[model samples]
Target: MDSQTGTHDDNMKPATKKSLRGFAAMDPQRQREIASLGGRAAHQSGHAHEFTSEEARAAGKKRHARAQATGESPRA
Candidate 1:
């Protein structure tokens, strides 16, 4: 039974539930270590995106337009 909702899911086994919650139950340091490994692998595999100046300028313009429409100030 779920403690928060007082209900149970019959389809999921205990091990499955534990595995699903495994990553989030890890410490902050361990989480960052795993994330860093993935980032390094992505860069090494030539899948990381490096934005050009024109692309960055377009993105900034879009953000500024959205902020102006919403009456929120854009960041520098």
Candidate 2:
């Protein structure tokens, strides 16, 4: 059960604009370990989406637009 929502935990709710919990709260080594597991799973499952040059450009544009709209400078 999710304490915040008081319901069975699922990802229906969007993440908060800011978070200091879960993997974000974990130490760097722990975060890397978790991220590595995710990458490995994606490879094993053959469901990872790879961006081509054009797709990457479009995705970058979308990300930058969101950041600018939020008054945030995009991180490198």
Candidate 3:
């Protein structure tokens, strides 16, 4: 019997994939509203990992605060 054709088990466990359970469980209309409000799109689309509107605003606020403390304009 060829080694390649042998029935030996490889014994490797299948990898667990990441899931978007919370977001995906929302109603379709709610999902669409979130999307329209700049929430991340579902799945691993290029835009999926991006910040939502509230997150972006919070980040901007933090950046502005940091810039002010360093005596620099936030625009820069």
Best by lDDT: 1
Q: Which runs of model 2 end up more than 4 angstroms from their true locations?
A: 1-25, 60-76
Q: What is the lDDT ranking, best to worst?
A: 1, 2, 3
Number of the predicted model whose TM-score against the real structure is largest: 1
Model 3 agreement with the true structure over 1-76: per-residue lDDT tens digits: 2379866556756579877688798889998898876644444456656579999999999999999999999999
> Per-residue alpha-carbon lDDT of model 1 for 1-76, expressed as tens digits?
7889988879766664445377888898999999999999999999989899999999999999999999898884
For model 1, the stretches where C-alpha displacement exceeds 4 angstroms are 1-20, 72-76
User: Candidates sorted by TM-score, descending order?
Assistant: 1, 2, 3
Better-scoring candidate (lDDT), 2 or 3? 2
Candidates' lDDT values, in order?
A: 0.88, 0.86, 0.79
Model 3 clashes, total count: 0
The runs of at least 3 residues in candidate 3 whose Cα sits more than 4 Å from the true structure, single-residue gaps closed, are 1-48
**What TM-score goes with each of the models?**
0.57, 0.42, 0.37
The TM-score of candidate 1 is 0.57
RMSD of each: 7.7, 12.8, 12.8
Per-residue error (Å), model 2, residue 62:
5.9
Candidate 2 residues 1-76, lDDT tens each? 6889888757576657876897678999999998999999998999888889999899889999999999898774
Clashes found in each candidate (C-alpha, N, C closer than 3 A) = 0, 0, 0
